[model samples]
Target chain A: MKQKIIIAFSVVLLLFAIFLIARDLFHSSHSMTDASCCGDDFTSAKQVDSTLIGYKRIRIIETGLKNLTGIAVNEKGDIFACGNMQVSIFDAAGTKTKTFNVDSVPGCIALSGNDLYLGSGSHVIHYDTIGRKLAVWKPYNNEGYIASLAVNGKYIYAADALNKRVLKYSPDGLLLQDIGKKDSITGAPGFVLPSLYFDIAFGSFNDLWVANTGRLQIENYTSNGHFQSSWGSSSFDNSGFGGCCNPAHFAILPDGGFVTYEKGIDKIKVFDPTGQFLSIVAAAGSFKGNSDFQLGNNHLVKDIAIGINGSIYVLDAYNQINVFRKKNL
Target chain B: MRSKTQIYILVLIISLLTLNLPAIQRFPRPEFEGKYQIPATQVTNIQPAILQYLDIAVLIACMSLISWFIVKRRWRKGVFWMSLFSLLYFGFYRKGCICPVGSLQNVTMALFNHAYKIPLTAVAFFTIPLGFTLFFGRTFCAGVCPLGAIQDFFAIRPVSLKPWIRYLLGLIPIVYLGLALLYAATGTDFIVCRYDPFVEIFRHNGSYFMFFIGGALLLTGIFIARPYCRFLCPYGVLLNLVSRFSKNHVSIAPGACISCKLCENACPYDAIDKPTGLSVKNDNRELIKKLIIYCLVTPLLVIICGWTISKYSGEFAQVNFKVRLANELMTIERKGEPVTPATEITTFRSSGKPVENLYREAASIVDRFYAGSWIMGGFIGLILGITLARLTIYKYRKEYLVNKGNCLSCARCLEYCPVK
Candidate 1:
């Protein structure tokens, strides 16, 4: 009888072992079969409160570019979509204005008055509105990858994701200063870019705002490169930034409002001057798909360009610029 | 054995599993001011290379000591204590990595993949145990192997399984070995390491699925004794073959058997071969007929198994990450659904690699799997055929003896001999 009980218990344990193995195999196989869809985490995070979304996608301008790396809008509302060894311009009404070819694929683009500054590879190239190459400046840093460019009257700030520094260059492309470095005197906590997602933009006060993405904070620096203050938080809530590196790309509004686009969870949000969470311009589901940043096809929203009309032009991974406008507008 | 000590050990192990402290950060730490830089996350560096070599050295030393205890000293108590030391040192201290069991996959990968440079430590770990088993029988399993030692410690009331059940269940290791080799050779995965029942217990962390499986196997080990070594270990299959031709194997008696039945119930692993009296006369005509029939049937079984497994090679190829991704992409296209932009899909797009190139690469891997599955299936079929054929012939013995292929050389039967 004792042996019988032992045998019965052993049989039960054996069945349990078989069940465990079978369950594991089933889960793995199920995951493989379900690989065609987004993961549960992604799905759960994708569904945001629709009422919180303050903006709507107004238009999708298909630039016909094979790969859209960066987009910039000028004061005159002429949109420049640069990628695939060419820069295509679209008017404020989403009409194709002009297109020009470059020697190499433009890493990023910024418009200074009528002249366009293209960050191609590690160097900056000056171009006129009609696509004439004006001057090619020396490479700011040969090893640097210019992921973003923000230009002002006196200087051009190139966000170098490789060196994890913002290179401030003169109008003629002379190296001026390296901003966002850790400094005891200036109280600058150096930029911690986990991936190639450092972005820089000029705020309403002309103060430089840099996305310290790894820290999930937006830092403010003086135009001359003095550290001022920073804001933002790390959270899965639509009001906060999350993931490895977020606020992947951001553009400053005329009223000093911040338009921030995050990768991984792929949500675009807006914040006031004091870094208060205002509203979500686009949720994760608003884009083509949820993009978890990786080396090769990283940028979900490659570049966020704000139009003069407060329209947010998002250069999505699908090589199209999605224009989002406030629902009140 | 003190029940209190056993309970304490069990509690300690459970605490290690339950205390899932945010020990290892999966993401990079936020950089703060001052000299606080987040350390670089190392992908696969569990231990340093020097320590890896030390693990090999320790393994050899332990196996040598256990081999001496089993073969020369013939001391069961010494073997038991040494095995406990191995369980603590190799199992818990080293976290059961660089084990000979998992090293077989490294050797297989190195053989099949030209780019894979088999680490010197892996080569040593794989060969040293086989070399020891060749000379001194399965003394490695007797105490040096932490997987076996852990199970051995739990085997207090091991009941003898029927011969037919043992023979039927024994085929699992062969099938597992074949599948492990196939997966490794194809560079799909290291399944032997992935499904190692005791490695998680040794690490005190890992997939909960594996932890539960390990717990279930341990519970069953109370009655069955070394269930994994006998029926599931891919590495044990190799040791069993090598130990069969061992020069110095374990002895049931110090000298000749006194015909006493004391040693009959001694082996918990049921490796003892009882004497077959002369009353069972050998029938040569019947044996020859069965042998001829088995010879004819074995090759047919191999072909059938090879063809059947080859037919399902596509399903098996899904285990490969690349093949699975390609299949997913194709499925999305076929279903007319928007690509969900998974990490793999996004990375593939950003690579600027053409979709055709990915599909072509995945197809090539599937072709390799097709060839590997045939061989894997034929290997399993051949083992099954041999196991079935082995039942037809029996060697007549006048005295009780140890089955060298089956015995773990644990030295338990040595104490049962009154002649000692």
Candidate 2:
């Protein structure tokens, strides 16, 4: 029995090795398919085009946002983004919105109707869509290092990047069983080190889509957290997330297109719903930041929202939110 | 009839790739070259650091192959030449650049973020060792790497880890994968560069504690097995991965074992994963399951917790807040805001040309691309871990190796059979 098992094991290993080499050799066979569309700076061009949304391009608003990490959209279409010790909100027309003061670093955000959920050092605080504080949802081991957050129906999901799992909770702050990454059926890397989840929104089918900060990839999971599809990685070119770990966050447009915010290179890129990278709404060169600060910390750009008629709102880290009116859409 | 011809063809291919190295060297791949202005592509990276590794890697490949062909039948002698060559190159000629293991950075750079990466010539250097592993087994470990050469010099008495402990330690490639990505993600110095013990050996010092640990291991390598070859060297792991799947394999002689197990007993790395007298599936299943479980739990948690932590609560951040203040302090040197440190470096690099004024017009570019980064780490680790573990778990049956399909018909192992 041992002998047979040994041989079988070797066979399995051999087969696996063959699969890897074959895949590797064939990688360039696709050979940068559709390079034509992305070349000549198609993505960079889209970031500033008026049709996609105004936030697609990097714009200077009210400056002096230090470590701004999270952004959200309310029912009234007002824009709010989180920074160190403060949250900045803006109206729909590129006007100066209100800025809220807070004590901790706000890393993630979620908006439900008039209620906004923000993550701050192991505590989840509730606010009226108008930015008024309501209730607090604190986890058992909440150590303030929350990386990303999402709200689906009544359930809220928060990734404890350092702890390597996502905590599920009810709106009233009740603890639910954890969907630990280890429990995931697909064999994937653990999220021991989590960064920003730029955007998290309910899909048409209610599944959750996540654009992870450090991985430069977006992974989709069942509302219950079963792993499904994943795409994107660190890159400067249109096909990949630019930088060591980027495409930190993203927003899914009402039309199912995606606008991703990356750090290392500092740009926002757009993609068709099916994952075809389209264009860059904005590039980092237009923005001013620390020499070392590519696109990290509370550098939040999560405010991607479609208006009643489909205009897009982007909450730049600056005090004012930028609005884009799609000429065609 | 044409195995040698195929080998020559591979050499030719590698040579062509090598010839293209200077072009790649002169024009640093855009990924590694961060831009000076906004919309970065227009800027080019020009640095001597780029060419440092390429030159040595080519020389090592050239000389090592020549020496190996000369001493084709002498295992230890060939290893001596290869290792001596690595030591001279790394010690006297090269600094911290072209080691084949470091080329992992290039492959992984592309696999992960497709950012600043190693040139193709650098890739060929790694391929050369990998190719040698296929054609000759473990010579890469015997010498050829400066890391191995340094350790070989200090090898003394050794103690072996139990098979299980060795197996557990062998799983380190996974941790290496995680560390490489973590540092890369942070835009920190390459982890391999910062922490390599051998680089320190060549450079003459390292972190006191880590160096001592490496020194002790090096001392322990002589009596038992090639300790560094067994446990810590990432390059060793890389070569081993290629060795297992190598087209030409090490053909051990019949009765060479004598079942004496001296080589096994002397071996320290515990690279030998003996089949648990139990069924291979029964023994290895739990470990595989745990590996899977560990991988999935964290990302899901990151997803959920990242959301929870994002919910903002108070007014401290409203206007000149503490977090904002701290961020500003950290960013001051880099941003337009003048600071002490960044000013000094730029000032120094330019011989006191006001730092800010020089880069004032230039905008930092995005997309520090390293091609095939994630995949490179992921694949290499997976391949090495799986291959080495498999080699340990099952000793190839005598008949299986004797009748091996891809043997270069070189019966070289037969000539060196000390036991036979």
* Candidate topping DockQ: 1
Kindly report which residue stretches of model 2 are placed more than 4 angstroms away from their true locations once superposed: A1-67, A94-100, A130-132, A183-199, A212-215, A233-236, A284-310, A317-320, B1-420
lDDT (0-100) at residue A240 of candidate 2?
A: 67
Candidate 1 docking band: incorrect
Instruction: Show where candidate 1 strays beyond 4 Å.
Output: A30-237, A241-256, A284-299, A305-311, A323-329, B1-43, B338-352
Q: Looking at model 2, give its docking quality level.
A: incorrect
**Which lDDT tens digits does candidate 1 get at residues A288-323?**
333222112233678898988788888887787888
Expressed as tens digits, the lDDT of each residue in B146-204 for candidate 1 is 89888887886899888887887787778778878878998988888878888887775
Per-residue lDDT tens digits for candidate 2, residues B142-189, read 555666565554433334444454565555544454445433443433
So what's the TM-score on candidate 2?
A: 0.39
